[model samples]
Target: MTSRQPNHKIPETNIKKRIAVITLKSPAHLYHCVPIACELAKNQKFKVDIYTDTEQTAALIKALTEDYNVSCRIQILHPALGNRLLNTLTRHPARAKHIISHNQDKFRHYDCIISPDFYTAPLITTSEKNRPVHVFTFHGAGDRAYGFKQQLCLYDLILVSGPMIKQRLGEEGILDCTHSVETGYPKFDLLHHTAPKKLFSNHRKTVIYAPHFQRKETSWYDWGLEVLEYFYSSRKFNLIFAPHVLLMTKWRRRKSIPKRYYTSPHLHLDFGSSNSIDMTYTQQADIYLGDVSSQVYEFLYHPRPCIFLNTKKVNWRHNPDFTHWQ
Candidate 1:
């Protein structure tokens, strides 16, 4: 179902437009959204509110807003206990359903909903009158085919990071009738000054082996263990075995991470921690080794050596999914 395309005429008076910025699924979505909410909060014509579920998310919102020095109403939501309990068993595909089921009336009153994801709003909810205009700020700016292959046309407005994303979405015809604007990466605007932890004792060069969570395309399902063993046994470089946040987010419940990976001083294995989402691994690693994780781009901020492992013997060259490889 499609949202109401933002056809509302610009207000000539001082009436404040109410907007809701939601940060759900906790894998770098908040970083992309805080700046947008902060910017809107600066204007008198807009009344921005931040809605989230977890204490971790609320705390993050507080910290980020403090950094920006922008104050707005932050609504911390506690979804039904059953939904929270169920979310622990499966992936986050059920999150949107809970958000919609729990906050239907509250969301309908907003003039707009600015989310870090597209489908998190209209992708799940049915089209109905009084629904807020969903403005999705595309967060996963990676080259994975999943990024471009989605039904992005559902949102009322799409905010992209750069021209590359705009061009890619336009080429895919996702922008045919959608209202989108390139606002640049809002996360980057808040340059986090927090330094990474001192993991290894030695002064050896650090290497981060960050793999994506996708079962079909990620190197973790096939080559993850081998990579971990290689770094653990070799001990030549300090290895940061930090996979995508979603990997542990989903699988950490069903299976337990082998304790041996954490035995070595050279091996620093993190599964879904605040540091994992923050730029701790990205800033500390001297080299990047991974599959299809978008965090590689963040690691490239300092210009380091990167090695992308192709677990599946697919022809990635000239493929739109592997555009970042080019």
Candidate 2:
């Protein structure tokens, strides 16, 4: 009898599936997808990469990783056009084109791509070779018609918060039952576990006046100053005026707060803060006041008293644009 040596080869243990989380537009959008990214990064079988367009988003990603004790690759997508003058002339659509053109090649190498917004649908769907499975997680629960556009059907998988979203998407004939998954809003997962810090020292009820940025749809262009004056003049409640993040991004013409309004101790005006995306205002506020912003849904998580401002006062009862108001 002779002992025979078995032939064996060591298998590679370093292989990990790669995924990409792309965030554009605002920090809120980035925050909406952080929970998913962090969860993916924590898994040993996968490697996660986050691509953001702003410094604030990069900082937020770093903080999230430190807080969660997970590691992932972070990339900031800066405008490829070197000159600011040329960028200003080209405008937003051109900038978006440039970003997609610069990153489309790298994105194709990933096994999967997750996006919180619909803007990236074209990039993922148009790729003819090595197209990764595209997943879309809506950043909000708003009933805007744009949310139900034909582009939504391009995604391989759509993660929705509740049956309401599924129903809406189905009605539009844009979603396939086979591809949709009912996953509760990931952003709220963080909001529910995290403790909200007290923004004001006083015990008085706090009202968060968060208006949208669009001149046509926003309350800011209509009764923004009037609303502020009402809150400033009244001493019954403390006010936190936090408008949409894009309100001051490019549009310089905005309602200037009167000096008298600032004198009031009950009023706290925040144009845009780092904590704006953290739901600090929504959690601390006793009442929710807003135009068409989806932050209203966050406030409604607690089921508090809400006041929707219809600046246009266009019969929203029949308007599909104001379906959220119903």
Candidate 3:
């Protein structure tokens, strides 16, 4: 493959280049590259503006801006609709069209737009008069069963994580690597930080069960409850249930999983623990048990020990590298 730097270039700019960081969801997607963005801005040679959906993320970016003294402007992507309103619009096209027309122009006025949702939103900005660059970062689970390749072809630049992903995309005949880059994850830079305090300060043994969302025969609703039951009753360790964040929201309007499982007192369910940027739990947890999730790579930064659920053993043996755990 071409050099990683060429793909995700750190182009030298004598003057600060105005950058717009667009966060459609949680800033967790920014975890992979935000630090680099922050550093580039700190040089007094780059200005970074962040557009996020929530005040929580805006506040976080504001604090980072103050700490770094960079021009970190925060703005909301207007014309956003609540679940109730969106549901109503689905039934009424006239109302949806009005809402769409109102927010059409809010997408312009940016030099480069970096989005984590990995969809067509970034490309939408390219139609503006200035014609800014759009970058899409893949944050979803990649599988052969799913038609992910077709979905990925829509972006200008598709930034992937590891060498395995690079190889897989190439084998799939995805010639889009002309804009693809394997930037060694910026989030893993945390492992390089000199934090005095340990990531986890507890006497109790910890086990993190981070399961991926399964489609048919295998599901968190199916076999995962049993695993949770075992962890809840066991006195040997403290348990963390960090399921794929989308599983709770994507399938249904399930807000938060109730803490009723804490009947044993050793389990902590972090359904409310949300962060756009840093997920430090993967660094702190003692043992990680998960299915097919990318958190395994983050967990590997510390490399304590891990277990794969393997509830569905369809054909991972044919392609070992597909699974991060292998």
Candidate 4:
């Protein structure tokens, strides 16, 4: 017993799991993934990183990190091409390729890649070794065919809001029941718990007009101005003219708003305010008005009157594409 001696070395406990949360398009998309990112960042076992394209998105991510007291890195992905002509020729496929090439090494370093987009699916699948798990959280609740596309199968895990998404995936024969989870929309966690702010001080009933950005599907191209003018003139209801965030951002479609609309006290026009993403309008409004925006579902949480604008006047009752209308 006196001659016995033991040597022991402590095991390492400093290794942290790596996760990247990517928001490729807009601030709205970033909002959808913020809860997941924040949760992961809060855990000391994980190292969280966020990749965004725009300054607005970067700023928003920074705010979220500070607010949650979480340490995370935010990287901005700038446009690859400077030439307008070259960019115009290649479109999104070229951009996707550039993003993949730029982040290939970064993707290999992560344990998981979570994105609120479809394009990132291809990027994550490109990794051959130390391949990170790909997770997709769809950004909207709208009945769009693309939402249930076959490309989604590329993801290792799919987080959805409800049975509607699972059913849609099953119908498409792409449902991985083992990997799919109905998390009841992470965005709702913020929307439901946040106190409603008075967007308009007046007591008039408020309506939120949130039209989609698609040219073919949205009422904006056909009757957007008309709807705005109608509400502007109406003294019956206070209108929150908040279009889809992307609608006003497109260079080709950006139109000058009438000065009268801005001066009107009854109207609160927000092109892409932070309030729009936080569901302030949805929470405060008495009525929901929209063309194809999934925000209507958020407003429906309280089950109020909803008026859908069908500028195309398609037989929505019969068309599967217009299922949200039904």
- Which candidate leads in TM-score? 2
Q: What is candidate 1's lDDT per residue for 1-326, written digit by digit as tens?
A: 33244566434677788988887766467877878898899888899999876777788788878877789888866556787677777534446657657776677677788887655565435446555777888676786656764466667788887888888887887777677898877766655534457777898899998888778888887878888778878847889988887777765532655678778888988887777777788888899998778788788777889888987987988987776566
Q: Least accurate stretch of 10 residues (summed lDDT) in model 4? A: 1-10
Per-candidate TM equals: 0.87, 0.88, 0.75, 0.86
Q: What are the RMSDs of all candidates, in order?
A: 3.1, 8.7, 5.5, 8.9
Higher-scoring candidate on TM-score, 1 or 3: 1
Rank the candidate models, highest TM-score first: 2, 1, 4, 3
TM-score of 4: 0.86
What's the residue-level lDDT of 44 in candidate 3?
Answer: 71
**Distance from true location, Cα of 117 in model 1, Å:** 2.0
C-alpha local distance difference test of each model? 0.76, 0.77, 0.58, 0.77
Summarize candidate 3's per-residue lDDT along 110-195 as a digit string, tens digits.
Answer: 55667665443423534534655666656543443342454455455667766767767777655353357777666665455423
For model 3, the local distance difference test gives 0.58
Candidate 3 displacement at residue 205 in angstroms: 2.6
Where's the lowest-lDDT run of ten residues in candidate 1? Answer: 1-10
lDDT of 2 by residue, 1-326 (tens): 11112122223477877889988767888767878999989899889999987777799888877777889889987556664357677665225546766667778778778999876766543444456667889888877776777677767778998988898888887664226789888888667446778767888899999998878889987898899989887868999889888886664444366777666789987777766767888888999899898888888788889889886876889676677688
- Over the full model, what C-alpha lDDT does candidate 4 score relative to the true structure? 0.77
Q: What is the lDDT of residue 112 in candidate 1?
A: 82
